[model samples]
Target chain A: MNLRTLLEEKKSSIVKKWVHVIFEQYPPDSTNFFLTQKDRFLNPVGHAISEGARDIFNALVDDSEPEKFYPLLNDIIKIKAVQDFSPSVAISFLFLLKKVIRVEAGAEIARRNLTPELEALESRIDQLILLSFDIYSKFRERIFEIKNDEFRRMTFRLLQRANLICEIEGEKTTPGEETVITNK
Target chain B: MAVQKPEELSKVVYTFPSTPWMDTPVEIKKGIFCWGNKEKSLKAVGFPNPRQWSVTDEDWKLPDNWKEIFIEGLRERVDKYRSFRLFLDICVRCGACADKCHFYIGGGDPKNMPVLRAELLRSIYRKYCTTSGKIMGKVAGARELTTSVIKELWYYAYQCTECRRCSLFCPYGIDTAEITILIRELVNLLGLNIEWIAGPVANCWKTGNHMGLLPHTIIDIVSEFKEAIYQVTGLKVDLSYNRKGAEILFVHPSGEYFDPNGNVTFMGYMMLFHEIGLDVTLSTYSSEGGNFGFFTSNEMAKRLHSKIYAEAKRLKVKWILGGECGHMWRVWHQYHNTWFGPVDYLEEPVSPITGTKFENAKSNKIVHITEFTADLIRHGKLNLDPKRNDKYVVTFHDSCNTSRAMGLFEEPRYIIKNVCNNFYEMPPQTIRENTFCCGSGSGLNASENMELRLRGALPRGNAVRHVRDKFGVNTLANICQIDRATLQTLVDYWAKGVAVRGVHELVGNALVMKGEKERTTDLRGDPLPGKEGE
Candidate 1:
């Protein structure tokens, strides 16, 4: 059997193991919560991990273009980006899927001699790790941007109230030469 | 070739570390922690052990007698406040409050769990105060109060917004906020405080406001508002400052003077007062309604709050009307009478226009603006045209203090439903008394802690995102001044395209004035809903 059929046959187990491994990166106390809690609103971090893992696995099996992975990668990365995780540890979950797949289906894969197919699938996972890095960097940059913007926005209205910031007038309109346009 | 399946690869088992929580060392990571208290701010307030220090430093430069002082302060607080003592004593660690914290929900840090956040101090409490803890030691969940534990306490105490969502879920009525408050007070004994809180406390203590706006500066800013009001409504609403015999003294969180959303809400109050011809005077002496000192210590809160009643007495106002603010009302409703009681100087607040007695505020004699306005609408005292707010699809975020602390659930909603044409409620769990915090409450809304604030904001943001997706909610209306200032950044980051505004901003937008100009725009100078072509 080919890798696609094998992955499809073991889709639920593979995805479950993948999510389990991803959650292991968190503190041991939180692992049970990240695994057990199912409410999306109540446990957003957990939801992102489980849902993002499933979505990434499906997209990989379906041969969806890598660009489709950005949003899926971004969903989990955004949570970890602000968390206490360092960059390497935050992005490490994306790389853990390969090990999970190997563990869950190693016997089936070797018996079927699907090593080449597995290597091909593993390369796609590597590509996703690179995508996660980009998403992680973007969020970190956005956080810094938010910090700077908050400082400016906090005092921005105060500046306007204090008359510290003046509105520079555009080129003065010539009397009777103002261009009037009809709304179409 | 025989495939060698790994010996332990049958199933994944999560191995929880053998080290118990007490043995797990605290690591104060950056982006989550605030900068240490500035020496100038600590000295300005006459707090003990004023000195420069950084959280990132190896040595926190604490006073040598810090531990003794901390234990003494804790003992005094536990004795003085029965609730603090009860909270420290009665927790069963039922885990009901574990998932309730917005910080824990967002960040997934086990430490952020309300149960554990409390235990960060409770462990020390166990080691020092309780008999079992002192005798049994680590087995009894007690540990030594080392410098590491102090850092942990400082880190987590500030993490709590004191929103009380956990307390609502607790079976024993344990208020983690009280524990956080007590821990903060103890930390302050060692001169460990965050700048966002210290700066405001110093400013409010010295200048009668958080912004340090002197009387002239406040008047100048009010005159600017006067001009803006004229531009909007074509009426010169009279504003009295420090004038005697005004009948009602108006105190507002000073953000209303300069914050864009708050300015419009202030304009709303001015317009409402003008329409009703109410006798009210704004005070430069007690210029700010927000008591940042409440975030510091009970004594400091009293010191900052004293000015309001003093100003009311000086102006000879019968009662006080506070502007839209969160913790200010918490301080007023919960602590005001206790701080300065038999407040016989000010009469029970009776709305001069509607003749409604604010019976709830009879003791403290300070009426929340929402309650006051809701009464006005009920009495048909002010002319309102809700259609002017047709552009906004409004959702009300019940500020944590107002809803959970004061049980002010319906007043703001009554006001918002009357003003805005389109209104939607976020999920039931995320509203009313169970509302999530704006994440910046309790003075955690500093720029340095942006990551922490944004992470803490997730639950509220997620709820907003839900409504924005389902109902296209475009505007988030709230009554709290801190909500007005902080929720905008929150919505911008989480639910893009949604704008945050005060409920009274909508009141200002929809209010029809007697001598108003042919209306072209709302208070923020935006075109009226259907008048886009104009």
Candidate 2:
């Protein structure tokens, strides 16, 4: 499931249009714009998913099995909880990946491709976003719920970090170490 | 870490000249100009002592009429608001803004905490205004507004620089400073504003400035700087004031009218504008660029902003340029557009020299002096001689309101590098959006609260000293006039030998104005010609 190769064969116009729409949807402010625009993958959704895939792929190629990648993905999802990322948004991100892969790699890879592998990844991200949103929504629900300043502060850092990660990679990366396979 | 005892905090006293208040005529009884029992009041408040945490007998007694007047003022301001929905609706209070505060990091005081500070206003709003708040009350954890709470509000509201750094971290993007301003406005309505601030506000109302300096005094100061400019650059650039038909009107903080360091920047701005062939005028009627009304209430803010607009209209200038003052720019950049509108006379500012349209300015009508200068430099229109500033190692302190609230980061740094050699930056954490306030911001530099001012300034002084010691830096340059003034006092008291100057002053010194020798200040310490290299 080489998502990059799949994205490459697709008509550039459809990819370009979708990329434009996603960017317009989440117009990057000063902090996140550079991560998506300046990178080799100009499309934010593609850039994010590819980065995630590249990290996992590199880890797998390094002789680390799927077991290491799954937990790593889970940890990233936990971070997404802090970012107040929506599960729907994460699910939408996966759909974007499927769309890009279908456009670039054609129908065969789209049917048998990265979808199954990314399902758990999307679920993990969705759960994390939901958990973070719950915490954030509850915290903001009441003023007195603010027991100590530290609770509010820690949650904020989590959200800020989550937002940065989601904006950059299009998916959260694992918290712990993962294998890295260098092509060189 | 063990918490220090309240007694352990060092005590410092501030004494004001008695003559100014003593001579106040009997006729002016109600507002700031009226004289009161000075020594008794001073002792009652414990002028130099570390303020007691608890509100005590020392709180100055206001005339019975004062509260009525204050509440009337607040009612007037609240009535002016079309909606409080934005105020009530925004602000999730995740506390991402906690670490962003300089005062919070510097003092480690929980009260200085931005979230907690905002909660003070939020709690009050919930108790009185909100339907959910009224029904739930203590169950919802909403607290009643008492005199003690009002006093606490006064104390905390003054602490904020109104920098808007917290807004950057906010997910919904709430500005806590706006809440602080509203709290202060409400407090002022209750006739409970700190006497020190009220005096300045009144002075600003009476004399077109807070410092109470006369128009002639402003002219005298400008003339003296003109002489200095003449001796240094040989340019007979006329520093005109209250002149009609000038293409642009320049407004600056009243501190510039008195302080030498402040005046230097003022002269620098004039020299640069002259060299660029700008048709600009200075108005004594609205000479003070700062709106203390911003500290007080929205009505005052509107009133203060209106004065500038009226002056510009009276002068019939196409555009108005603001001087280097932090909160002034915040008000200008954030609210000026909405507050003063239908400014149909002025075209949206496209730098005549740069061709860069200032579309992002709150009102495309008025321009901040720093942005104007930076744009001119960016366009290659201004020829600067950087050799003039070789005497000192310089770094810029991005004014919090300018950098964080407005996203004006690169332009000033670009101006700094072009104007001086050896332009270095403070540690990355302290520059740009993360810059610290110079303790005296947000009207905390009031003469009455010198101890509080010193306590607040300690962090900035420490940062400046760290840079000076590590980098052998001799001068700290910034674009905000208040930062320069506040830091001048801070550096003098804490980090001696390090001088604070404006970015424009450095540029003005570096620019080869028409009468180069007569009108410009020297880049080096002495204006002597042969002292260039040595």
Candidate 3:
């Protein structure tokens, strides 16, 4: 298969596997706090990814433009790579997904008796999510070079706005005092 | 009312000493201040009020109230300029402007860095204006004002010749001289100004010119020179003054009225105009073409510059011809067009003789003495005897403001080559945009800053020595009156065998009038009249 087709198929399988993992991580208990907090925090992450994906898909459909979608996908992979998310961090995310999938699989087992086929599906889902995060992390550096001064300045300003870089209180000495001493 | 005698004034009132050096000989000091206690010191004898002087060692210890009043006035003046904000905001500190500064390159001081020099004003601006500065202070590299800061400002502001060389190299096209002017204005407001500068400025305000010569005294000096011209060339030139309805008002630096080298150039200007039969009259009221206030404060600068328009109005002249003074042209060419408004009484400068319109304000309306002479020669209007100035090998010293700021590179050289037998140039960078100062320019020539002045003169002195040793150049010619005066002092003390003269002085020496007697004296005080063999 061509790279584009192979990548699209791989992305589709990874997304399906992640969705199953998310379901397993949240149990069906009526008062589950993790599920309640998921909508507040994790939902935004999901919403942002979905929005990015939808924009890429729309650009592809409108002009049959592969150049447009390819860069966006590359950028997401680059961000994942340079962040140097430890293999453990990726595995932890997979483990969380595994828990959600297990709960869904448990519900299925309860509705009908436990089966070997259901357990095998859960293992396959776990392996797929882990592999996708690993691949994304490896290609992060090349993605960063696409965004130059404008993008860097924008991103820097955004991070500053978010209080990612700490700021200290004003100095006790006034400007007049420092300049006078230095110039003298 | 009778004017007060120089002796009647207190010695303390008039004496302003420049910076002292560690190893300055007592003899050198004595020679520089030869006027001594007779109230003859140029710095001391000029001031009207002697008792108001305070001899404080520190600049900060001056009257606090006067300082506050002056600073407030300066702030008001600077606040009126909206372009200053753009200049303050635009510098990227790329350091491209460092090598462009003659002082910075010659001295090798980091503070002389153009961006850093401009930052002296910019940092103060940020402290008071920006939000980040108001909140974070030194984290944003802002600081408050203090006594030492004021002193440092004076030191660096004086270092700049206000030549505008840095403006050409700046990517954003910011002129640091504008900042230097602002700092000087602010300093003047504080009453923490140099005495030598204030003395001349006050004189320019009280008298018509900076030298404090009375109308009759000026008449006597001009009449003496006119007699000298007649004795030499047998030409009775009409050099009148304060006469109403003159077609053109001719202005020159007051230094030209007394100095021998300056007189040669003045005589050259007279001979050329007399030959052309141009209707020009010298102004006894405002004879000084050079503005010392340009190196000091804008209020004082405006006060001194206003006299030009006032004199023109008084005389009903159509145009004014500026003589060969560096800063004089800088003020007229760059600032006069902006500061003086609706000058409808005078038409834009059109050469009354050639009928050619001068559009470039810097070089056009205000013609250099060299350009005027060169143009005359180009048109074959005057009969020049090039052998008259053949006594010594000559080289030209292009003043930075003229050659670099005004792009007057060829006219002076062309005039020199046409008049003198052997003409040479100093090493490439030392002559044109990179020409060194005589160390006494920008008003630092006063006896007060002898050490700094000597240090600054080193580069120019060395450059002259190069030409003297390599080409056996016995005479150096320049167009700026200040260059003549300052280099006279430098060459006398440092370069013993070489002498400096104005370019016009050489031209005038070579000039032979129609059916007139041949002139005898060359610009170097040499008797070149009948020495056709040498």
Candidate 4:
């Protein structure tokens, strides 16, 4: 009748369901690829999503320390952040964990009169969702930063190499920084 | 009673997903990546990106004579590199390599596909070289070389890791990596380059290494490792330097001098040499074994790699022993003689400890470290106890260059098996000749285009995650500096708890040093397996 033990016991199956949900988020054409190709080399994005989802779930299940767990959560979110998903859609998987736990273990929770205990778990999921928002936003912001910086290499490279008159701000590149500015 | 609705229970596919660009013309935008090479480097190597031009802009600021330059460069390459000419003419466009590229698979940009990436250059080749293209332009799979096409080539060329996996599946055995190199060469005529590559090629030309570390700093790095050796083994291992008339002149990838895990591999080399009592000297002049210039162009790669034979002749060593590296092996095994050959000065490489003739490297006079070590193990020259590295659940990542270019698949694995008790291979498709790049090869490992790099690395990381889940693999061992630097990020990002190391670094941990202390920690100062509580 112990709902906590029941939740802990079904962790792997709950993780599988969470992974399946994330795989479905891939394109309709790629859905078969993500599902059928178990080889990591053949279907890497699928493997990453599934593996990353499992890591976050296990970390949540074991109640690992935040110091030990945030990095794991970041690893997964960073990939999704840079992908085509909008920020909300990128981190929606963190919310999927809540749905997975409820769907997988809802019967066990109600049968044992574990609403208050399960609510505690649900709130923890909410806390993780908030944390994931911070991680995904930071990651998305970084992609934009890289985009601006990568294309800007032409100015510094061309001006200096061509012997065009130019100016530099400083030694190390700061955010919103340029190494060169051409006269014309 | 609380059964979920069927609609809610089923998988919810999101709208606005990043779809692959299937036959869609590329849009030149700042949001998409085109990593720029540095100016000093472009100037150092004598290339074109000299006048600042942005990839995001509608104009690349090409000179009035750009058409003349393209024709000249194309003609020069076709005349010189038969492979280039053949690759341009022979593609049937069967699309065997369409889904083969790691970048294409991960990024979803169809242009990142090997077939299309090559076609970017091949279409121009068709227009200029073929008689049919002159008759039926744009219809015979030929497109005019517009600024948009040039910009598209710039974006996708650097995206390719030059892994050459696509070459294996082609019916004609067409190598896209060759097309990538030639296009990289063609772009250089316009002075366009990514800094990660041009910076290293420039530095290697001037400072004898990629990081621009001066000669004195290199000795200081070796001195620091000596201190670690003294701390671990008690007896100070005899560290030789630039010794002329030595029996062996050992060269390693310059990244080993300072990269965190690379230092571990360097220390492993020192301990192994000391343990085997081999008389060898490290070269300060030819410090770098791998050629960054190789990625720049054939001439630049040849220029950089020429230093090794020159150093070996200067030192008058009996033979040359190379350290654990990927592209260095590629250059040594495949292109050494063709680039800078007639190395008739030095004698053939033979292991002093094992007395193996090194028949494989007899003509080249350069022996791979894995080959030497595996030979030593075959003769039972090592006093290894595999239990020393018992903490690790090891897996070998067959570096793309060594696997594809050299076919060196077994020697490194033989050494890894001897040193570590637990070692697992990634999925069959991911290892050996079919290995995915570390995602940042060919000078694309820039901090700015991490989106491209991460997408490129997704396949490699995905395979790492499989073993970490299935077999509890925690250490990814390979013989690559780029892999060492980039896979650290990859493992941390995709498969946490897994660490990356050189194959030889594991060997050093297992080496039973002579007159050594009761060691408590292995290299990198991690506790030895049995000495964990100490």
Candidate 5:
């Protein structure tokens, strides 16, 4: 069989392996918990990872364009963005798919003289990795934006109180010039 | 290590940690922890060891005898509160609550597990306060109380929002939120407090509210609300400050008068009160209904919350009417009588308009706004136009304190159903007593800890995402002030178009007042549902 037929035949096992390896990045205890828990609300992170993985795999095999993967990639990347993972380590889970595809269907491709087709699939995975990089940056930027917005809202009352109450009589300090205690 | 067989390529190795949990060192990650209490804030509250320190520092600059103080404080608490000591001793660790924490479910941090978070303190309790622990040591799951242990305790203690979700599923009825409370009490002895809780505690103690608004500042903010109210309803709403002998004293979280979302809720209260002609007066001194001190220690909670009863006595109101806040009602319903009780100075809260006695609050003499509003709606007192709220396909998020502690399940919903045509409940497991936190309750709602907040917000946000995807829910309603602030940020991130609103904001939009001008917009100045073109 050619690469497409091989991939379609091996789709379930490949996605399963991809999700399992992705969960392995968590702590051993967490990995076990993720594997065992099936409730969506009870184990949201696990659900997100598993569901996002299958949808992303199907999207890839269907030869969908990169933009079609935004929601799927965003679901998993959003979780990893807030998690205690470095940026490279956070998005690195995408790279593991190539290794899984090679391992799951590599021998079949070789025997069928579909090495060029396998390379094309691997390049698609690379494109997904690049797309995840853009998603990671968007989420990280969204987090910072959230922090800024929360600060503005929290201080909304205080700022309004300051503006409507009175002018500074003595030191005349600006609103942003409070003695902020910073710790290195 | 080449794979000889193709099946070996998918071989997954599951290696358990060699070190026991007791021996595993704690690493305090950045973006997950809060900033330490500033010296000025600690000094304002007369707390011990008022020195500037950072969680990232090598030396936390604790009092030289911080260990002695922590041990002494823990022992004093164990002696003082029987329930606390029982909670410390009775946990069987069935792991029933292991998967119940929102943080654990969202972030996958094992330490965020309710059992493990409590064990951070329980292990120390075993080492210092128990005999078997002294003899068996790590075999009995005990560890020495070192600086690293203190750091870990601080890290995980703040990670818990004290929502008590885990306690709901505990077979042994182990209240992990109490454990987190006790841990925070001990850490305060060492000056290991986060700035978010400490700053508010100091402000509440000194300026009568968390935001440190002076009496005039509060009045000015209310005046601005008055202008907004006049512009919307075309009639002036009467407001009084500390007016003696008023029939009721209205105490709300100061955020209600200040924040944008809270301002809408505040306008809702004004419209309701004006419609009924209720004799209610606001107090600038007891402006804050939320007790941040409750998150710190019992003593500080008492100190800050004393202002409510004190203001009531000063004003000589018949009874007090509380506004839409989550933890404030928890403190009122659960701890008010114990902290400052016999409440003989005020009378029972009887609805002046509907003549319905709030028999549930007979002892405390403080009535929740929903309980009061629901009673009015039951009596068919206020003319409500639910169609005005058609712009919002709303859902109610049960604030943790109100749902678990106060059992206030139906009052807010009753009010919501009366005031809105469309409302939806989240998943069965994620509403009412089993509700998830906005992930920023108990004063963890600070800007610096955004990642921790977002991580903890996932379960609640995910449920919201489901409802929004399924039912076109555009508005999230609740009775909590912190929810008003944090869940807005949360929905902005998770459910992009979903807006966070207070339950009362919907009420204000739906209430049809007598002699009101031709209304064109809701309390938020958004165009009304049917009046959008005009």
Candidate 6:
């Protein structure tokens, strides 16, 4: 069978596998609920993961335009970006996509004359994976910036009780500057 | 292992150390706080102690008399609001409210505990205001008003969603919400207002809306909404604006006019009004039913809330109908009469369509849109087909204010159940008076406070997650505009597939308008269940 036709045929199963692989990072209890629930509305996390995975797979199959993937990738990655995944593990679904595709493609590809097409498809996936890191990094950066603001807010009470609201008034101060109250 | 989900956050993994909360200094943590207010936004509204400042600065540049101003402010508030004095003096360290605070429940932070949060301010109140605090000092549970104390108040006050769930459980009925509002008021006096809230308050004071949408901008947006209705349904929907002598003048949170889902809900309002041919006018002057000042101070709340009745009187409307909002109703129900009351010019609000006398709001002379719509549905006035909303298995999230402050329990749910075929309730504890705050409420919805918001949202998120696991419920219908903006982010982080929607948005989708084209999609432009699968 042609590579494109194989990819098209196995897309649903591939998206499912990719979602399961991504969800494995969560606790088993959570994963059970995230995976077992089928109702789209009730199993929102699972449904979203499926929908997001399906969109990414469809974009990958199109191959006509790769930019279509980012918007879809962004919607999912943003959730990941705010979620508790490490930088590498969070966007690592991009890597898992390759495995799902290869596993579904099967070893029969070696006998076929689809080597060039397979290599080209794999390389496109590689490039998209590289771009996915940028989205992951940017979102992580935003979360960091947000955390720094919160951290500073902790010491805000100390600053006020110490009579610090007006002495620094004339001086230009940058926003979200981390100042810990060391005063006893 | 990564804590990808709230359930994965082990109970043993403590949010705050077991060390004595009072003895230890508050260590700043990530994912639990945000930078303080901008100086510009504070100065715009003529807030006290206004000066250019940043939350990151080591120095806040306080006036020498800043301490005196705060004390006087406290004394004045104590005299003015009896609740303020009683909340401060009546607490006996009973732990009834400790576990009830959503912040403490979700974050596991001791300070998030309503008792501890009140203590942060109460210590100072005891210090300067009481004689024992002056004499015994630390021994009497009183601490001097130090920069650290002020900073601690800022940290803990914002952490509180001020939903008053804690107060409901308090033995002495010490309302931490009222206390928190006062702390924020005192904080605002020091120009420590967060930009997210201050900016909106400034805009609303000038332009009559939180988002700073001017009169012309509102007109253009409403006109565009009309155009979109025409384009989609092949029917004209012309909403009136600032029209004097109209039977009813409608006001909703400005967030509804701008946010995507909110706009869809507003469209639902338009469709309902248009279908019924109700003589309702949308007022550009009283465009916002929300009062951000309620989050800051009673005076600010009074200033902002004044626009409603003033505009109603100016426009000469018989009565007013308020749209779906949480805190707006809080202000309307509890504070409006106390603040800018005796709206005697406006007659008692009775729905012209269903002829339902809203006895609950007849005294206030303003009716909640949910009350109006639910009444309409009760009278069989609306041509609703529940099949239109078959795409959604929905659940209702009673916004904290509407739940606790107004007790608007069944009104919105009545509309949702009648409009949608499938409706599921979360744990009984999580709905009605016991409902959890969206966490981003009371001006904590700023992006800078994302982590605090996520952790604080955990209780509600976990509850919704439960229903999502049990039932096929994908949509969370709420009445608050803050929920419209913040709950979306909350759901995105905690539960991905679930979407946040206003109750009326569902009502509009189910509403079969006269002479409309065959409906293909809901108000949000999502395809109908039968229309799909083509």
DockQ of all predictions against the true structure, Cα-based: 0.28, 0.01, 0.00, 0.14, 0.31, 0.04
Cα RMSD (Å) between model 3 and the true structure?
A: 26.8
Prediction RMSDs, each to the true structure = 6.0, 19.9, 26.8, 9.8, 5.7, 14.3
> Per-residue lDDT of B473-532 in model 6, one digit per residue for the tens?
799998988897777767755666788889888888899899999988666555788787
Q: Give lDDT tens digits, candidate 2, residues B326-416.
A: 7887787778778765577776766766677777653547788778988888778888888778776887888888887677788778888
| Model 3 lDDT tens row, B1-534 | 012355643331211123221111111121121111111222332321123323233334444564355446545655788667678777888876764564443333445567777877666666666777668876665656556566566666766667666776788888888888877667655544555666677677778677787888778767767887886777787677788897878888887876556767888788778878888888877778888888776656777888888888888888777788888877776677678755777767766666666665332245566666677777777788888887769988878678766778898899888888899888775667766666666675554443344435545666676688788998988888878766765554335588778887877788887767655655333568475343
Point out the worst 10-residue segment of candidate 6 chain B by lDDT. Answer: B9-18
TM-score of 2: 0.63
Off by over 4 Å in 6: A1-184, B1-18
Task: For every candidate, give the share of true A-B contacts it also has.
Answer: 0.41, 0.00, 0.00, 0.24, 0.52, 0.04
Q: How far is A75's C-alpha from truth in model 4 (Å)?
A: 10
**Judged by DockQ cut-offs, is candidate 1 incorrect, acceptable, medium or high?**
acceptable
lDDT of 4 by residue, A37-150 (tens): 666567666666777777877776677766666877776786776565555567778777778888998888888888888787777778888888888778766655544443
iRMSD, per candidate, in listed order: 10.2, 23.6, 37.3, 10.3, 7.8, 11.2
lDDT of 6 at B21: 58
With candidate 2 superimposed using the best TM-score fit, by how many Å does residue B336's alpha carbon deviate from the native? 1.6
Question: Highest lDDT: which candidate?
Answer: 5
Error of 3 at B328 (Å): 1.1
Q: How well docked is model 4, in DockQ terms?
A: 0.14
Total backbone collisions for each predicted model = 0, 33, 18, 11, 0, 28
- TM-score, every prediction: 0.94, 0.63, 0.64, 0.79, 0.93, 0.74
Q: Write the per-residue lDDT of candidate 4 for residues B212-311, one digit (tens) a residue.
A: 7677878877887889888877868777878998999998888887566788898999999999889999877798987888887888888898888888
> Cα deviation in Å at residue B283, candidate 5?
1.3
Full-model lDDT, candidate 3? 0.60
Instruction: State, as a TM-score between 0 and 1, how close model 1 is to the true structure.
Output: 0.94
Off by over 4 Å in 2: A1-184, B1-93, B131-136, B352-357, B361-364, B492-495, B518-534
Q: Give the TM-score of candidate 4 (chain A).
A: 0.81
Give the CA lDDT, 0 to 100, for residue B71 in model 3.
43
